[model samples]
Target: MTGGLPLSGVRILDASHVLAGPFATYQLCLMGADAVRVERIGGDDFVRHHGGSAELRTQGMGGSFAAQNAGKACILLDLKAPGGRDVFLKLAAACDVVMENYRPGVMDRLGVGYADVKAMKPDIVYCSLTGYGPQGPFADAPAYDHIVQGVSGLMSMTGTKDSGPQRMGLPITDYIAGLTAALAVAGALHQKRATGEGQHLVVPMLASVLAFMGSYAIDAQTLGRERGLQGNAPFSGSPFAGRFDTVDGHLVVTANTAAQAVRMVRALGLADLEPLAAGTAPDALSEADRARVAEALDRTFRTRTALEWEEALGAAAVPAGKVRGLGEILAHPQTAAMGCLDDLPLPGLEDPVKLPGLGFTSDAWTRRPLSEPEAPGQSTRDVLAGLGLSRREIDDLARAGAVAGPGLPPRSA
Candidate 1:
């Protein structure tokens, strides 16, 4: 590719955990950045658990963790302790970026805020992902993905008219904020290259979620029309395409262009479905006729299962699809054909770890995936050596309760 794993030499100190922050760092790792995830000294990142067996919990990982922390190194550090904070600062001096998802002032309270690190490394790019921006009345209010959806007006706009205030099933807000953070950090990196200075970024999940609802927000402002949910339908104020319940599961048929819509309606034996297509503009379809055509097509789609509709519509060159459950999609042959998942053997994670495999190469596609996530603090000794902490220094820190590594799971296969 033109960029050569563009961030090849970059170093990221990931103080963030959970979905958004860790996923962002995972993307960085794919781009060839050296991202070290710093965890609490008492244990590893708590993202590893959600009430599975104790052995699974002790392995300190789950499917969720696999998706987020796939390509980052885990280093145990107690930011609250004096020695731990010192070690973090030393690592900061060697890094290009620092990421955190703490409530607004938590890092400052720990004496490792942007100011502290900017002094040590002036060109550092520090990004903060939060539920709300810093310096607001709700700055300290705790937030998870679902809460952000409710608070950001996303829940109000989701689902059908009867099912009001439905939260998104996926973590949409978190992923959007992570993508925004990555974009901001990339921009800041470019500026730092020219100006020899760093920038502090504070992006909130609520704001990111709100941005995703731009069309609704715009309509409310300009048309004075309140947004309404229509369930699995686009808000383009047109029903050119809608979700249909097929023999098995569902399929969404979208023909955004009038020509495509014409092709679809003809293919479905509903040639007279819409009004005056030969006279109207290419992108414009009449409301009454469009509704009739959509209803006719909906009935036609129900004649077959989702997969059948998918293949038939694909042959007609129309955009149609069936949404697959995560597990089903993961196990499908296409997952391996596209090379999206790989089972990399790990030291302790019970099953061979499912490493995320995604990256684009101009030459072709990539088959060389990153190694799996290391066992917690697996490189503690080597990292301590790089930090110039002698074995005696490390022993002193260990004795002072400044460090620890992953304890093994009790039950073995």
Candidate 2:
């Protein structure tokens, strides 16, 4: 491990699951924070078998679980049980941060809510992430990424005008919530350092998604204009910006600037089809003119392969690249040069698994060597031992189903 990761020495007790909560803690874990994921005794994270192939579920290493949960330890404590709640309080008292992402009041009902944990550790940074917020009409509604996307107006603004509303291909809302929550946690930690006071942070998926749609929301309110999908068109409303088909495949090209637009038409040998704007002017072509230009460009782009167009457009300084799928992009030379994708081992897998890397770069943060993703509760005994629990006590708890790990009772069906 490289020295001086930003979150080094910080301890976080993460009692959350699914995507957003786990991902937020995962970020800290990657930065050398001691992120301990606490789950119910004899239970597994729903995501452990949520997606991916049947083989992954059998191996207890689902791709969805491994994708976001690297570099964290797992512990099992039945928080619903009195003994389990006691164990959790003990852990919270020793940790710097505690986080959970249940519906409003779920944690409080569990008796391990923010106030309860803060009582044990006055300066603990606590974050409660939820779908909406603690107090709102929709607060009690169950929400997932897609539901939030639709509610937040993201889906209404995506896709083509012809396709109607469409959900994004990925769980964008969950990730946005996770990233926002991580940022808030970091900021609260910083403030705590100066004031010697902990913070209670509320990270709402609806709020995060709205933040992502800030510009659109502002436009709707201020200009009385609601933006609609334009199907691969750039949000800037530039007619010169969209995906095009090459002789062999497709490519995405954006000539948003006037100069680039001129260069693009000229590059395609369509000098006669000069744009109405020039030299930093905004795209103002009428519908008919835009259609004519697009038709001509389409014919021209079809004259060359995607790679050829990519090179030619790149040489002319127009922003463009060949359209690529997930597999192709992951295996691309650029990804390899950045050291962003790695094949690491997963639990019950004989071979290394390929996964994406961190989003940001830091000279002081080197990813530690990869270890197989641990099964839920795999470290329960060791974690309890670190809390100074005697072997007899640990055994007693396990036998009573208050704590579970390798030798514990089978989960109720």
Candidate 3:
């Protein structure tokens, strides 16, 4: 993976845990960076024990943790301890990037904050992912994905009016923040390479959500558009841009342009609505007319299966698709064509775990095959040994509750 990617040979110390910070470092790993996750001594990432079923969590390969931490090495150091902090600073001096997702003052109190790290590594890109920025009224308040979702108005914009505000099923904000952090870190790395200067980055989930919702807020301010739940409908209220039920399942048909509307109406056997399809703004239709057309379309769509409608609409070049579940998506032919999923071996699991790889691909570079996710402290001894710690010193640190490694007793507080 390190062969020809843009971030090849970049060394990163990933002191982040759970989703957001870990995912940022994971992105760097995909770009061929030598990213190592430094776990707390004697502790695993909360995600490792929080998600998935009891069976999976007991195996210590909770689905979420495995997905986010794939392709990274794990080492443990009790940074509160003097010996451990020294080892961390040593690693910082040798690495290009140091990343964490601790709260604002936690890192400073731990004595491994950016200022502390910068003194040891003059050209280090230090990135922090926090719930809110370093200084804000809510900065000190603890935040997670769902809390930010509600605070950012994202929850208000989801679901239908009847269901009220509904949270998105996944940790969307966390993933978005992680992706943004990765991009920011990459830019900082590029600048450092060119000018020999490092950077301190503070990425906040609140800021990331606002950025993601920028267009929405701008539209409200500039166009007097009110934010409201529209369910499966497009915000524009385009009649064609909604879901309709078929015999078996739902089909999403989006015909935004005049030509697309024409094709869609013609395909659905609703020629009477052809004029409306031909550049007629949805609001131009009377309520009666809109209701009549929706009724007709719904009746017609129910005559066939979702797949049947999808194929028919596709043939007419009107954008359409059947709403699919995860199982269907995994079985779909397009999923195979995308080549975005891989099966990696995991310890104690009988079957190789299938997981999504990079969201995109490049002709110029290829991601290396994924290695299984590592257990906490899985590579501690090797990492310390690489840092010039002798076997006796490494063993001493383990014995003194300052460090942990594979097969060694977890350090006690």
Highest-TM-score candidate: 3
Q: Model 2 over residues 1-413: C-alpha lDDT tens digits? A: 35777888999999988899988888777766787788775565678886667887776677778887776778888876548888898899989999899999998988889899989999999999999998979989988999999998888888876789899899999999999998999999999899999989999999998887778888899978887775687765677778999888898988888888888877877787764535332346667877777788788889999999999999989999999898888878888878766576875568876677567666765764556678878888888899999888888777666788886554333
The TM-scores, one per candidate, come to: 0.87, 0.94, 0.95
User: Model 3 — which ten-residue stretch has the worst lDDT?
Assistant: 404-413
In terms of lDDT, model 1 sits at 0.74
Give me the overall lDDT of model 2: 0.82
- Of candidate 2, the 10-residue stretch with the lowest lDDT total is 275-284
Residue 97 of model 1, lDDT score? 97
- Candidate 2: regions farther than 4 A off: 42-44, 275-283, 348-350, 409-413
Residues 105-178 of candidate 1: C-alpha lDDT, one tens digit per residue: 89988989999999999889999999898877888899889999888878877887778879877888888888
RMSD to the true structure for each prediction, in A, is 4.4, 2.2, 2.0
- Please report, in order, the local distance difference test score of every candidate based on alpha carbons: 0.74, 0.82, 0.85
- Residue 353 of candidate 3: its Cα lDDT? 61
Query: Taking the tens digit of each residue's C-alpha lDDT, what string does model 3 give over 1-413?
Result: 32398788999999988899988998888888988888886675778876666776877778888887887778888987758888888888889999999899898888889999999998999999999998969989888999999999898889987999999999999999999999999999989889999989999999998998877899789988756776887655667768999999999988877788889999988898887775446586788777877888888999999999999999999899999998779777898788787787777768886677788887888766788888778898888889898988888888777788777764545
- The superposed Cα distance between candidate 1 and the true structure at residue 389, in angstroms, equals 0.6
Q: Once superposed on the true structure, which residue ranges of model 1 sit more than 4 Å away at CA?
A: 1-4, 43-45, 51-56, 274-295, 331-359, 364-368, 406-413
